[model samples]
Target chain A: MVRQKVLLIKVGELKDLFRKLFVVILFLTAFLFIMLSRFDSVAIEALNKVVIKVTGPVMQVVELPARVIHHVWTYFYDISHIYAENQLLRDENKQMMILQNKVRTLEVENQLLSRLLNYVPPAEASFMSAQVVAESGDKFTHLLLIYVGNEAVKKGQIVMGDESVIGRIDTVSPPYAKVILITDINSKIPVVVERTRVRGILSGNNKDLPQLIFMRSTTDVQEGDIVVTSGVGGMFPAGLPIGFIGSINGNRVEVEPMADLSRVEYVRIVDYGLAPDAELSVDFVESEQNAR
Target chain B: MRDNWRENLKLFAVHRIPLIATLMMVFLFFMPINSVQINYFRPVVGIICVYYWSLTRGYIFGFFSAFLVGLIIDIYSSLPVGVNVMIMMLLVWTTDWLRKYFSMSSFGVNWLAFAIICTAFLLLKWAFLSLYFHHLLPLAGSGLGLLSTVMFYPLIAYINALIARKFLPQERIDE
Candidate 1:
């Protein structure tokens, strides 16, 4: 009798109490479902897919203004830079061609020496072109959704645009992948200067550029030097052009990336990983001498 | 159902006018954005709307609505993995909590609670991004922008409350 009376009293305060209690139960169930994955990757994946699908349209709605801005931006570019910029570009191209020849010649020499020294060449990266589906971020974390390409790109894969490194894949759905840009404060990479071959740490500053920190003051790096993946830690492939140093201080350097991140429409994600027995082939001196 | 339809129609007419007015304001604000680096935050509209729905119909606007709103914010802003989802979930939950003491009828008290939640949210987002990136992202530039977000909050809350009072259900003198 007392138990019945307590139940009746408790039930009276909550309107549609049983139904609300059921909803609360269902919500707890969903929370448990999310947390209870024990190497049960498939369920987690399906849940992520459901979340992505439900969220997709909403994201598109949010992107309307940015899309409009981009379209309007094109009109300004066409009108403003059509004539005068062509002449400027022509001059720039001529100088670039001259520099390009020198670079090609150096590359050939470097390749020959590497072969002579029995050093393994950098892995070739594959490019996948994609369209920007959306741009979403708050004050802290900014990310972009790229429509998945025909070529499969996975999480942690390096993504490049304009032959310069942009960032890497963060997550993937079947037809879309989220890319975390290098400018996020969380981004880090081991990089080496192409001009001076000075190896150091490269990390983003959450600004328009990233900074190379903790380099030896005597490090042989300079402004205008190209920064590429050192491949020292195996996060990225060597020889991938990431950015160019825009400023250099005593032990710190700032880089403006080669990829125009704002207008990145396509990117390449090369299938690259650490080589087997990379440590054993450290100098490759024994292999070279044996070959000789 | 019949009375509800009548109520909905009246609600729709009342709500439609301000919504259109707001949309017109947004359209005009967006139309001329060529080279100007204007600091218009698009995500605020959807957030304010979600808060409205959550307060009016908490049961109806559960996790999914909050999730959808966050995703929309992410889409407009270009964040990875809908990080706004996490933030919005917290915001919705907190507002729901504070609604116990302060509902829409409570006026300034409710708005004050909402302001604290929004501020806490901005700080939380900053904290998450910093923790993820492993460093502060130069907050003086970004931090000032955060404070400015507070300035817009009261205006956004006021506009949203005015719209909400017109639609859904208002506190009735007859009740």
Candidate 2:
């Protein structure tokens, strides 16, 4: 009986040792993964894609209850404000009618001038709408997983919310893609002040407002000036409205994104085909046109 | 013999309750609530699960289960790969070490212990991320997340305890 007891104790000790060793190994493996991710390896990307493909459907299923609740709450809120909204829209619509006529005249004059100059128009952007299926709602990161549904969305393609630029596609797995929002720390976009044309790099700090950096010392940048994509990098097209400069303290300028990123339910994945290597092949373009 | 086999299968299913619960919490963490306040102050549900399970059902939940929970969170989270994994594993290790005190203590004492441990975990995460990016990240986000998680512990723990009492076998609960 004593011998059996001793053997049991020995076995327990061995098991405890094994558990400790396993924990150490797990810690090391996790650190190794963090290191591998820094290099942005293809293996890690492939692993991410496989995981996302499996979990994307699960996320959609889990999100149904939340979606229903949100819609119900929004319905009541909208009903409460419907009268005021209608009045506002009527005022905006009358102004838009006047602007529409002026814009039409300008469009005809611009077309005639382009014909005389023999100008080749830039490739028109094609877009597909996607519903946000999941969000990284933690304090540390701001990313959204959108259901692409077999539409070809490549990494670095621009994602727009409502009427303005919100983010770019960070990863694309078939049927799902991840958007790194402009408020995420990893986001960086080259932009120019619309009024003075002073260019700067907009950097996200994981805050509501992303800060503009790298502008010249003497650059005249004012609060409330519009910021647009500078097209310095081929990744984004020129003149895409990003946001308005909300504040300036010395060299630090913060931009408040035009899109209410918090309430984004649907987004447009635009293929500007602006990247040097991102141009669609003539056959693909023709097929797209035919399909359209 | 057939009845014995069926009993063993039932036990096996019961044993997985903690893991399944933790996985569900992970899904909840990623749910798109779309409220700015909720988004910024979201609790670290996975950490809470790891801590609670490791403290109460260490033999069943195990380090491997904690690792798996962390891996799932890492896959879903936009933070650098393995950050959550490392944090979860550390939580398991710490909870395992302090399980005796935590198990013997009252709920308030256990919560205090968790609050201290969770604060350290979030700070470590914040420090690691700041180093990774080579910039000082704003700490208010981590501060708020920690506050949310600490405040949320009792509710989640209560739910977990109820699940354990209902579904888990007495032997596992005693362990």
lDDT score for residue B37 of model 1: 29
**Model 2: per-residue lDDT, tens digit, A1-292?**
9999999999999988996788789889898889987886566778789988987787677667877888899999999999999999999999999999999999999999999999998889999999888788467788898889888788889999989999988888989888989889988787889889887777889989999877764248877899998877577888999999898888788999999888888999888777623233223323434654
Candidate 1 wrong stretches, greater than 4 Å: A1-49, A61-69, A96-124, A205-208, A211-225, A244-256, A260-292, B1-47, B56-59, B62-64, B67-90, B97-114, B125-138, B141-148, B151-175
Candidate 2 at residue A256, lDDT?
A: 93
- TM-scores, all candidates, are 0.66, 0.91
Q: Model 2: which residue pairs collide?
A: none
Instruction: Please report the TM-score between candidate 2 and the true structure.
Output: 0.91
Question: Taking the tens digit of each residue's C-alpha lDDT, what string does model 1 give over A184-209?
Answer: 65467667888778866667676767
Query: Residue A192, candidate 2: how far off, in angstroms?
Result: 1.5
Per-residue lDDT of candidate 2, residues B4-41 (tens digit)? 88888888788889998888767867877767777778
